[model samples]
Target: MTPRADPLTVEVVELIGTVVARYYEEYEHAAAEHSLTGAQARVLRLLAHEPMPMRRIAASLKCEPSNVTGIVDRLESRGLVERRPDPADRRVKLAAPTEAGRATAQRLRDSLDFAREPLGELSVAERALLKELLQRMLGMTPE
Candidate 1:
């Protein structure tokens, strides 16, 4: 026999699930608006900060390396991404975002208004409290 969660806990969990589902739905819509699949848009967004090897990218995306290869292939064909030799190791290849890729990723991010609109309504203190609580729940240092 297992102990049951309290009412507040159950409600919080359900709200979290709802938030995640809504976020993904909005992300998919934004991706399609840019004429890019969710996977391609995600990869491009991941590369915005720095180039990453295919294996690392696959791990980050939680997908197979071959799938990342296909996504990269499509993005490369569109002149959005380019593959380059990893400077640290010649044998490794890194995927980097081109100017267009960066622009597209920025646009995609900008178009995600689902959370932004609601979050914008939060006061600074309330927003900080929410962030801190969420970080704590995820076992991260509340910074």
Candidate 2:
């Protein structure tokens, strides 16, 4: 039989879900002003960082390759991103953001300035503590 989560685990999961939902809502609103959906904006942001193979993009987005293809197709249609043959392998396609897409990603990131407000409520010490705790929970490094 499958094991069930304890009450504390369930509560923590619920809290995480709530925070993620709120963050996404804010991002969606900010992104909509630039005529991009949250998923599309996310893809563009990833592309802005570096070119990635379609399979890697799908893995990062936790979606199927087919879904990533559709998202890339829409972005390409908007002239935000383009697909090119990977330099190392002609058979492999890579996604790269255009200048317009990089600009859009920057604008979208600037619009969703959530950290500037509520985070301001915490003192530097408290912010450090919170960051340490959250990083521990996520199995990540604070830096």
Clash count per candidate: 0, 0
Against the reference, the lDDT scores of all candidates come to 0.95, 0.90
- lDDT by residue for model 1 over 1-143, one digit each (tens)? 22246777777788999999999999999999999999999999999989999999999999999999999999999999999999999899999999999999999999999999999999999999999999998899999
| Collision count of model 2 | 0
Residue 78, candidate 1: how far off, in angstroms? 0.7
Each candidate's TM vs. the true structure?
0.93, 0.82
Which runs in model 1 stand beyond 4 Å of their true positions? Answer: 1-4
User: Judged by lDDT against the true structure, how good is candidate 2?
Assistant: 0.90
Query: What lDDT is obtained when candidate 1 is compared to the true structure?
Result: 0.95
How would you encode candidate 2's per-residue C-alpha lDDT over 1-143 as one tens digit per residue?
Answer: 22245777777788879878888999989889999988999999899999999899999999999999999999999999999999999999999999999999999988876655777899999999989989988899886
Instruction: Give all candidate RMSDs, comma-separated.
Output: 1.8, 3.2
